[model samples]
Structures are given as C-alpha cells and as structure tokens.
Target: MFQETVQVLERLLRSPSQIAKHCAADEDPRALFLASLCATLLGAAAFGGVLATSRGGLQLLYSATKVPLALVITLVLVVPALHGLAASLGQPLRLSAVVSLVLAATGRAALVLLALSPVVWLALDRGIGYHSSVLLAAACYALAGLSALGLLWHGVGKSLRGAFVIACFGLVLVPTGAQTAWLLRPFIGRPAQARVPFLRHRESSFADAMYLSALSSQGIYRAPEPNSHPAPRGATNLADDAEEAP
Candidate 1:
C-alpha cells in the first residue's frame, strides 16, 4: 500500500500528464479518489502540525477538520452547479470524469501544501505575526490551488470547455471555502472569548471584513503608498478577530 501510495504521488508530482492521460483513458475513479484522499490527508496533517506550533494542541485538532470540510463544501456546490451549467450549454460530461478531475486537482494541491509545510513552520517559529503567517499560508495554498486548477484545465482538455466551468466553479468554491473557514474559526490561534463558539454571528460580509482590514494597517488590505508596510513581522494582535482567516 505504501509503495503504491508513493508511486501515485510521484506520478502526480513528476508526470501529471501521464495521470491525466490515464484518467482520460478511463481509469477507475475509485482508485483516483482514494489516492487523492491520502494525498490531501497527508497535506492536512502537515498543516495541522504547523498550526500546533503556534496555536494550542486543540488548534491542531481543529486544523485537521478544515481541509476536509473545505473540500466537501466546495465539491458539494461545485459539482452540481457545474453539471447544471454544462447541461445548459448542451455539453453533458461524465460524472466519473468530473469526479476524477476534481480529485486529481485536490491531490495536487495537497502535495503542494505538504511541500510548503516546512516554510510555514519556519515562519511561525521565527515569530511572524499571526495575521501575516496566516495570510502567507493562505497565499501558499492559493498558489497551489491555482496550479492544481491549471492542471485540471490541461488534463481535462479544452474541448470540455473546462476553463469556463473552472472559472464558475472557482467563484463558488473560493468564497464558500473562505466563509466556511470563517465559520470554523481560530484554527491558527487562541480565541478571543474564553469559550470556543461553533458558529459566531457574522458581523460583516467577508468582502467588508476584507475591505476594513485593508483600510486598517493590520490585515491584508494595503494602501497604494509604497512606503506603507504591513504590520510588523511576527506581531501578535489577537485582539483583532483571530478567526477571520483560515
């Protein structure tokens, strides 16, 4: 099993074209899903470990749930929406092919995250601020995700009109994942309240929160001035909603 897992991962990383071709050739979708699951779990575990470094052990536990939740939520919305869109356009696709494509993309993302674990750990250990660290980690994930999406487009073929579908899918998946992450707060640090709340009332929209954070000097939002820098590296400002970002 271990050997097979290693070989699958190697193919994913080293020769994605081969995997795509294999899938195109009608490889078993279950095997692809299983391999993707293993890859994603390993990546999530690495991320959880990094979270454990700064956040408490409890955070490590919470972090474990994030990826699976995000994946499930995004898929639930994306799969149906995409199928509907494809159908409306008179281009119905195989569910199995779509499933295999998404899993392949996710598996690639997981591997990418696993590779980034070390850098994240180092940045956290070096005392990067909570907000900065989280954003950086997210950026890493975003890059990985975009790469995976690119692979999806390439592997699935342009004739499938994958680019359009992926764009629509991304529009739904990204924000849903973000909001879901927001709901499952404090994965990166201690909560402001003494007790952890499962679902806090959303005071502001995600866009507003982002806008406000950008307007402020604290969050990812930055002004046009080149001289203006973000919060000091490694600054801990837990007073700000630590739960804002994933």
Candidate 2:
C-alpha cells in the first residue's frame, strides 16, 4: 500500500499523461480514486495544520479539518461542471472518468501544498505580519493551483478544445473554490485572538478579502465602517474583518 501510494504521487507530479490515460480508460478506477482521495485529504490536512501553527492551540485541529472539508466540498460542487464543460467543448469523458481525473488533479495540488507547508510555517515562525502571512499562503495556493492545472490539462487532452475547456473550468473553479474557503474562514486565526472560533461570520466575499489583503500587505488599510466593531490587536484593520486564507 505504501509503495502504491508513493507511485501514485510520483505519477501525479512526473507523469500526468499516464495518469490521464488511466482515468480516461477507467482502469481500476476504484483503486485510483481511493489513492487520490487519501492523498488529497492527508496533504490538505497537513498543510492546513501547518498554516494554523501561526496561531497554535485548537486552531491546528480546526484548520486541519476545515481545509480538507473545503477541498471535498469544492470537488463535489465542481466535478459536474467540469464534465458538462468538457462535453460541450467536444472532449466528452465519462462522468466517472472525469471524477477520477479531477480527484487526481486535486490530489496533485494537495501534494504541492504539502510540499509548501514547511516554507509557510517557517515564514510564520519568523514573525511575518498577519497580512503578509495571508498573502504568502495565497501565493502557495496559486502555485499549487498551477500544478493541478497541468495535470488537468493533460487529462482533458493537450488539444485546442481541451485548453478551452480547462480555461472555462478554471473560471468556474477559482471563484467557487475561493468562496467555499472564504465561507470557512479563520484558517489562520489572529495571533492576538482571545478565543479561537471554528468559523467566522461571513462578512465580505473572498475576492473582497483578497483585494483588501493585498492592500493591507502594502500597509494601506481600509478605514473601518461606522459602528463597526473594532479589530483585535494583531488583526488587519480591514473593516474590522481580517482577511484569512485564500
């Protein structure tokens, strides 16, 4: 089992074409799905826990659980859209095949995230400010997303229509994934937070939070709204709602 898992991870990073063919043929799909699912859950959980190291305590557990949950939910929501998009673009794939392909791509991304976990943890440990930490995490996510896109591109086919389909899928994916993660925010709790909450009340959209984070990272914070609650000492002063992970 360990050897097989290692082989799958290696193929995910180094031989996406072969993995794509396996998914397209639906060969031993149950085994493929199980392996990819395990990779996704474990990798995402590890990275999430690392992200929470900035704000230790129950946050490690909360972030670890929520990150995998977010990924699973995002996959559930987007797989059908990917199937439909591929079909519409004349790259029709069996729904099961599509599912396996997507799971593999996401698992690949999770592995990338896991690889980045230590770097992010080190940055947080070095006392990077909250806004900079958020930006750093976002950068790591973008890098992982790119890794996933490579596998997905191969799975769909390296042709023109496949490129179009993947592009369309990405458009749907970015916002959906972002909103899902945003809805389950506080992955990196404020360092000065009195108590860690499993979730935060939805204030702004993911796009808004990211935009604000970018500005805050540059030391240009948004003014607080009238009658808005004050932010915690170590939180970004973005309308009293600190931007969380992307």
lDDT of 1 by residue, 32-133 (tens): 667877887777667755765776556666676665565555655566655565556555657666666667777788788788888988988888775666
lDDT of 1 at 7: 77
- Per-candidate local distance difference test: 0.63, 0.83
Which residues of candidate 2, in runs, are more than 4 Å off? 224-236, 239-246
Q: Best lDDT goes to which candidate?
A: 2
Error of 2 at 193 (Å): 0.3
Candidate 2, clashing residue pairs? none
Q: State the local distance difference test value for candidate 1.
A: 0.63
| Residue 45 lDDT (model 2) | 96
Q: Clashes in model 1: which pairs?
A: 127-234, 128-234, 129-234, 214-221
Worst 10-residue lDDT window, candidate 1: 224-233
Candidate 1 steric clashes: 4
Please give the distance, in angstroms, between residue 190's alpha carbon in candidate 2 and its true position after superposition. Answer: 1.0
TM-score of each: 0.78, 0.92
